[model samples]
Target: MKDREDILRQIEELQKKFLEILANNPGIVVVNSDQTGQVKETHSTRTLAPEGEKDVVVEIENASATTHAVTVLPTIYLDGRQHPKVYVHLGEATGALPKFKPVYSNPNLVIGASKSHIMNKEGTERFLKEVLFIQPMPKHMLLLIDSWPLFLNHSFIQQFVPQGHKVTILNIPKGGTSLSQPLDLNYNQQWKSVMRRLNDAILIHEIDYKIHVRDNLLRAISQVYWCFGAPRFCEFRRYGWYKGGYLDTHPAPFVTPPKYLFGEGSEGDCTCGEPGLILCPYCEKPHCFICFVANSHRCA
Candidate 1:
């Protein structure tokens, strides 16, 4: 594992490399956007430190270092002028980005899961079926992915978050607690460290964070779903976590929704299905609540 010095040095190197890139292209500009989506543009100037500068950079750097874990910070480079900017780091890799974005189009729904893995997959699929297919896509989406991105398959992410929506995936590494509430799952060994392993995978990838992958996940999902008029996409949180850092416990059996909303035009029954009901997508699957079973480690 790279030590703190190595990480800082690497960051300095990247800055120097960026400086060189800037030198070659005089028109280069660095744009910084705050959480409000307000844009601020700045020009780069080369000035070696004057004879006696406080050199406060070291102190600021030290204070910022504590905000580890990816998905929090977002470094954007919008060369000169561009509408769509690319993320310079993966979601969780940057610890400064806010936990959620400002825009929430649709009414937020919470689907809790008994198991983290089950929550991951099931939440994704149900979002695809009910939310994406049924309702209009939001202008913006803020997603929280627990642990690492392992449970997610890129292809599926591409299918959701269709155009018209800009989704951000925030990762909460293992050993982190939700800003909202304590998760129902106990951290004891009885659960066999499943959540721990999942969290570790996230931390490993975040060591030297890269934004290309996160941008791809966001843009890919946006293009297919938005540009192509495909169904709207769902953001995965490795489990069911809503915006504002709210942690959802697995829903009780009676309240949980079904796996497939419309299975080949046949019925996908939930506990609430009425006897002799139409047995159709509209009747049985009332909402997009993924049964926690789908995200279980056993199924994964």
Candidate 2:
């Protein structure tokens, strides 16, 4: 539990202070960061096995669903690494609309696409070395990892973790990850539910959207993932940390997805004369769900 870790940390601090006083030594700086990431087997696989937790709040995990799992990724291999021209060429279509934008597109995220799509041993190490540590982190690091077989190799993970740092990795007990890890406590389910809502929107509206297409799939997932950035879900995330023992005090009560997003707020009529329940935040335009989704209505 975070409370327990805090006590233990305080004890260590006290010991260090006492020893410093006796030896006349100075104090040291500690760099702290917490985050999460996911290791997916395929593009459309909802099968989620969380990779690790960087800290208590930031989550690096996948949303559950398989609607786009078959977007095949071809493997490229070379010995002594061929020149850049050795790579297959693509026209502007590859860079066209519907890019797979993540919640954060810059240094905050390090992404890799693989043929298998799973973060196997090599991929996990790359995530640690490249994506997870995109920037120089603090000297003292604590990582919360599930008891997945790949993470069992301390040396392999250490190979990617930066040098000159004290990293403490604690693996959740087997079968305990579902409860011990903050990311799983409710994060994954909420994420899946959001995607399901989008799926429902797509189906019920009978829109001719090609969301199952690879590019469209990426775009849709990005849109759904982006929804969590709203204040309601962002505040609800703290509850997961508290449940996972990362937070000592209970977080202030906040609105959840169902209560906020799913609840029937003030009823009104769409501009098309249809009865509407959802209002676009940007335009305050009341829109029937079908109009909002099918027409892709938004502020001009």
Q: How accurate is candidate 1 locally (lDDT)?
A: 0.27
- Displacement of the residue 225 alpha carbon in candidate 1, Å: 28
Which candidate number would show the highest lDDT if scored against the true structure?
Answer: 2
Residue-level lDDT of model 1, residues 103-200, one tens digit each, is 11112221212221123344445544444323443344333334335423545655665665454433333333223111212211111132222222
- C-alpha TM-scores of all predictions: 0.22, 0.55
Per-residue lDDT of model 2, residues 1-300, tens digit only? 886666556544533443344244223221111222321222223323336633223232344443234211111111101011110111122332235553223222233444433345544655566544434454644455566777667777776766676555556555555555565676556655654555554444444554544445444443333334344454466666567555567767776553444445524778888776455533545676556544544343
Worst 10 residues of 1 by lDDT: 35-44
Error of 1 at 72 (Å): 25
